[model samples]
Target: MPAFIPDILAAIAMVGVAYNLAGAALAGRWRDTPAKRPAATPSITMLKPLYGPEPELAVKLSGFLDQDYDGPIAMVCGVSRADDPALAAVPATARTVIDPARHGSNAKVSNLINMMREVDGEIVILSDSDMSVPRDYAARIAAALEEPGVGAVTLLYSGRGETNGWSRMAAAGISWGFLPSVMVGLATGLAKPCMGSTIAMRRETLDAIGGFERFRDLLADDNAIGMAVRELGLQVVVPAPIVTHSCTETSLAALAAHELRWNATVRMLDPAGYAGSIVTYPLVWGLIAWIAGACWWVPFVALLARLALAERIDVITGRRTAPLWWLPARDLLSFGLYVGAFFTRRVDWRGAQLHMARDGRMTAEPETRYP
Candidate 1:
């Protein structure tokens, strides 16, 4: 190797460490948008697409049903088959939509298409089955949509491990790694995210975006929806309420596959931004510099920076997902998955193998079952 190579690597690592420190500072400044009830609370229809019985499925779904909002709320849980075990967890108050039809490669979007027929509310909210939110979630969402030029609203999320050790590891990645990065991205005006944690919009806005069918084949359906909403010259806003996403990975393999799929989706959505996210993993780059014969203090500072960011995220979110000592392993594992995402277009989603095209469209392999 050239003698200048170690110097170059160390410089890059130092830059990454600086980025981590900046992210920590940004996280410390984070605040949730105060919940405000709109003067007129429109009727809301929540579409929940379910595949199987995830951990705490009933509890999470019940959180939506017990909202404190005064408006009439109707929730429709969609399942491809009537015999899906997930249906057993649906609350008696929420209606169930059973359709065994495939609209596109994305089963969840297809489920939404079926559930839309039953939607009767002036406002529509689509949330993932694994998320649980606070009592004020509905009121906050409704208030945000009342803002002028707001086409849609999506909530931020924190991770909660609902299963074993591997689940905690997964949650740590989300809360510590993913959450902080998103904060930095939003602050820098580099990200426009519409997550499945909660996507709320008026029925007219949904109709204007051509509904969910336009995103049925896309890998990053939520991002695509946000883009579509933005094309209509309206903003998709993220409010103060942070929903809880239950991480239920039971083993290392399960955790790896799940995160790899997530990283792959992000890469598909914005290849350049995802590639630039290498600076988000300072410890990984610092270790690489150390291996390349850089100074010893490089990796040490990188570790400290990562720890600082993790601590800040925990403080902001008011919850700690894992121990500080577990961060190095989590960061290393995350970096590995980030690298792996670039090498493969195939990802596993709810027990199905999907091939992704450069255009962000997905195709499922033959004989594959979607949950």
Candidate 2:
């Protein structure tokens, strides 16, 4: 390792930092200047499939139940087991169904299939158990999917972790890193993801692609669903942005497991894109600079780049919730996660030992090993 190696690495890191800055700017623009589209037909069925009770789950589910949309609106929330606590928490405005049986490896989609039979709206939107939305969520999603060829619509979410310290950090990771990165990808036509946060679609288009059951075994179900719509030569659109529920990680181990599962899931879906994401971690590259050369200036540059990113993220995503001292440590940990993600092939998801296949199927390992 030579001194010049660090300088080169630092230079490389600056490029990525600049790219992220551009992305942050784009997110701010998207948030501030949401495309104003006239309200369309508002018949929508909001599907939420849940398995457990989470902190603030009541308030989150209630947000959708009390939507301001004037047209027909129905909600079909499912619980994997009849005893799952999530069903009771849903507001009475939405129809609730209890499904104890698992159709395939994917319990969420299984619940979706059961609930879909009961949905009675022209427009359908499915989200996870943890998402929270504004009163106009249904109206906006309906409007976004009004175009002739639009198959599905998704939203980029800013995290809201209301729990503990680690949970807040995890939220920041979503708001600051994942959200902004996705914005950059969309801005550049490099990434097209249909997120579960808010996947709006016409009932006909879902049927055109063989319905949600097609995603039963897929790990990145949302992405696969979006791709299937794409195969129909239909466009998957993303609305301005949405605020989804985020729980506190509560511990470093919890944060690690959470992010690692996500990374492995992405890797199984798109290996090339996952591998290329390394350049996005300027903090990691900066560390390589310091480790390779013992260069004092390399460390300073790393700190500067990281601080710039942190402050920029706060400003762009409207996330100033994190305390002053946590940014530095968070940046370092994020960089480490970026590097380590490349080597992980197995992840623990919902107490399941999931080994990611080259394709997107999450094959379960024996529960005994993980337990």
Candidate 3:
């Protein structure tokens, strides 16, 4: 390697550490203050799109129904198959739609399109199947939407790993890698992400954006929905009070495959921003610095900065998803996945092989798509 390579690598590592420290400061400033509940609550239709059985599916599903809202709650759930294990977990109070309607390549969007027909509430909230929210989730969502110029409300979600080691690693990836990146983006006004953790919007707002059908072919459908909302001159707001997403991938392969797809999706949405995020991994850059002949103390300081960033995230999220010893491995794994994402436009989603275009549209392989 060139003599200057070590110096360059060490400098990059220092930049990454500074970037993480900035993110930590931003997260502290953006801490969520509790929203006062609206005096008049609008009835809400919670749309849950399910594929198969997941760990703690029942508890997660019920979290939506057992909300503390005063308005009538319509929990409408859709499944591609009647035999889906998720069907058994659906509360009897919820209106279950087992429709095999393949509206487009995105099955989740198709399910939302189907479930929308039976919606009975003035406000519609679309959340993924694996999230667990608080009892006052409905109230907070309602209050957030009532804000002027806010077209949609999306919440941040922390990861909840199951008993398995791989599951914990996946959770760490979320709490450590994904969550801080979002906080940094939010603070810098670089990212306007609409997560599947929870998307609360009025029915009229949904219609104005052309509904779920508009995103039927998009891979990053949640962000696409946010874009549509923004096109109508509306803001997609991300509030505090993070939800919980079950991280139950039992194997490293499963975890890597899932995160690779996520990284690819973000890359498609904002290539420049995604490229700039390379500086978010101090540990990876730190290793490169050491290998390139940087002083040992340089890597040591970088590692300490990475740990401090992780601890800050844990404090913000109120969950210790990644242990102190696990930070280096988690950061390296995330950096590797980020690099790998650029080489492939294909993703494995719920056992389906999906081909993504540069425009973010997705099409599943015939052999892998559910019938």
Candidate 4:
């Protein structure tokens, strides 16, 4: 190796650490910003797509029904199975759509297509079943959409572990890994992410995007939807008061499979941005510096900077996500996933094996495999 190569690697790693530090500071300010609650909340129809039973499923779904928004709100819970366990949690007042119809390979988008026909609200909200929102979630989202020229509103989310060590680790990955990256991306104007965390848009925006049918075959449907909204020359606004995404994995395999699918989805959608995410994992870069025979101080400073950034994010989010002991392991795991994403397009999701095409569409594979 060239003598100056290790120094270059060390420099790159330090830049990544500094980036995360700046992101954490920005996150603190974003988190402290006052929630923008709507003055007159409009009628809302929340579309929740569910599959099988998950930890805290009922408790989390119940939170959606207890909202404090002044407008009339209707919840639609869609499931493919007639005997799906998710049905038990559906509030009696909320409509339930049980359809086994397959519209392309994306079950969630198909579920939404079926659920959409029954919606009757001025604003449509698409949130994942595993998320829990506060009583004012509807009002805040409605307010965000009412902003001029904003076609869609998406909420940022923090991970909430339901049970076991794996679950907590999954949650930590979101808080320490994903959330900060998203903040940095938004700050740098490098990302436009529309997430199932909470996708709020007017019915007209949905129609303009060609409705749920357009996303039925896509792997990164959330981002695809965001792109559609942007095509109409309108912005997708991400508001404060991050929602809670339940990280309920019980085993390492479950967590790995879920995150791998996520990594593949994002990488498929934006290859350049995904590849550039390497610099965000400073600990992994630090390990690379050590392997390249950089001086011991190189990795030592990198680790300390990584730890400092993690602590800052933890304080900003009011959660202990990256404890010093677990920070290195998490960064390595994240880096490994990023590498794995380039090697395969197959993902295991919702008890099915699916192959992702270069265009980000997914098709079912005959046999299931876990990464």
Candidate 5:
């Protein structure tokens, strides 16, 4: 059994090589758009779903209000109550809706659905309250949203840090680990992801999927929405990745709570795909071989594999240099989270407790008003 370990390592190295090669191609293809003044500006509605004010919330809110687009933009913010501290300094053009009405276990989508009634524009760009983007955000979204045969357009994000060690790790996990993986999928035509960070679809197409109301109970509502759009034979396009979110988990527990739920959600949504993700972690597998003292080749290949992915991701996302050694630490932690995911069948989101089933829908434990 110990002698065969090198064989396993070599096979795992193959997965690593495939991703790095694909990531290199993806990086080359991941072009950044020059800030072109839009030829013509179309009316746009920025749909924002809010729970409460998070760290740097005000600054994030300002990104949308400060856009340079030549189109009429309506900022629609919704809260579960009349006074979600998030309401304090929202600019006037931004409309606010207060509705405690729970549409389902997915509160964010519920909030978005309530706010959707306020939209009056040719293009609808849905972004989360904690997310921030550039001045060209609106114009870029408009171009993608206007494309024929497009159902949705979502952005890829990197971290905006708060100076904590673990938070940076989590952020790196997203920027280096998650973002490039998504880009690789996009380049290979192997993915259709519509993220809450930014999902701009025609108001009409949103209705065709039965709206956000249809995703009220889905755990991976973003992925489900994207799939629904694809079912309609339309592509969910993600052009020139945009920075749209940040990490706020300060403690290890906080990080685990935040990511574990996400892990379980993804596993539930794609069990086979989730199982295949084990190869994404070379450190843990290499450590197993080292602890057993079977083959020196395992650790050597693992180190090479991880560093290659990191380098590829750095170039692809235009993200800065990471402490190369920290990649292994992040990979081990991610592997731990992936293992915990299989055993976790419940999720706690936005102060709401939910039980995850084999399918991707969440059932509230105590049962919320909508569940």
Candidate 6:
């Protein structure tokens, strides 16, 4: 390697450290001012698509049913298979839809299509089964939609570990790594994210977007929905309240596969931005620069910067999912997964292997091998 390479690496690491500090500052101010509650609360139907039974499934689902909103709120939990054990956990107060119909490669979207037939409320909310929201979640979402020209509302999410050590590590990645990056992107106006954590829209907006059928084959279905809404000359807004996403990975392999799928989906959606995201891993780059004969304190400075950012996120989210000592290992593991995502487009989803096309469409295949 050239002697100048060490200097270049060190410079990049310094920039990454700066980014970490900037992200921390941005996160402190990222949340929007709480939207005032509308005078009238419209009826809401929350569409929760579940797969197999996960850790704390019952507890998470119960949170949605016990909301503080006064309007008539209903939850529709859908499963593609009749025999899926997750059905047992669905609250008796909520309606359950067991549909085995295969609409496209994405099973979750198919579940939503079936659940939609049973939706009776004027407002529709599509939230993943793994998420748990606060009592005011419905009120906040309903108010955001009532804003002028707002097509949809999505919530930012922090992570919660419900299972084991692996789950905590996964949670740390979301709270410390992913969440900060999202904050930076939003602060800079660089990302338009419509996450599945919570997608609240009126019935007419859902109909305008073709009613979930158009997203049946897309891997990043949430983003596709947001894009379609944007095309209609309306904004998809992210409100102040951050929900909780339960991390249930019990093994290293499961965690790796889940994050790799996420990384690959982001890469496919925005290749250039994903490539530039290398700067998000300052500790990894700092260590590489130190090994290449940069200043001895470079890696230590990176570690401190990362820790500062983690502390900021914890303070903002109001809970720390993993110990601070575990951050280095989590960061290294995340960096490895980031590199691995480029080698293949194959991703694991609910015990199925799917190949992603450049156009973001996914095709399901036999479980022959793992990436």
lDDT per residue for candidate 2 within 128-197, as digits (tens), equals 7788777777767777787778889998877777778888888877766787788889888999998888
In candidate 1, residue 290 scores what lDDT? 91
- The residue-by-residue lDDT of candidate 1 on 1-371, one tens digit each, is 99989888888888888887888888754466567888888999988999877877998888887988999999999999887889989999999999998899888898899899999999999999989888888998888898999999987788888898899899999988888777777888998999989888999999999998998998789989999999999999876866788999999999989998999989888899999888788788888889999989989999998898888878777788888899999999999999999988798988779998989999976434434
lDDT of 5: 0.76
Off by over 4 Å in 4: 366-371
Best by lDDT: 6
Worst 10 residues of 4 by lDDT: 362-371
RMSD of each: 1.6, 2.6, 1.6, 2.2, 2.9, 2.2
Clashing pairs in 2: 166-249, 167-248, 167-249
User: Model 3, 369: alpha-carbon shift in Å?
Assistant: 8.9
lDDT of 4 by residue, 1-371 (tens): 89998888888888887877787677865564656678777899989998877777878887887887789999899987787877887878889999988898888898999888889999999999889887878878888888899999997887867888788788888887888888888888887889989898999889999999998998888888999999999999888778888888899899989999998888888888888887887777777888998878767877887777677767766777534688788778878878988887788987889988998888975433222
Off by over 4 Å in 2: 33-39, 294-302, 365-371
Candidate 6, residues 64-140, lDDT tens digits: the string is: 97988989999999987777889989999999999888899898898899889899999999999899888888898
Per-residue C-alpha lDDT of model 5 across residues 155-219, encoded as one tens digit per residue: 88765455477777777777666776777777767666788788888888888988888989888
Estimated TM-score for each candidate: 0.96, 0.92, 0.96, 0.95, 0.91, 0.97
**Alpha-carbon local distance difference test for all models:** 0.87, 0.76, 0.86, 0.83, 0.76, 0.90
* Model 3 TM-score, all chains together: 0.96
lDDT pick, better of 2 and 3: 3
The local lDDT score (0 to 100) that residue 280 gets in candidate 3 is 83
- Write the number of the candidate with greater TM-score, choosing between 2 and 5: 2
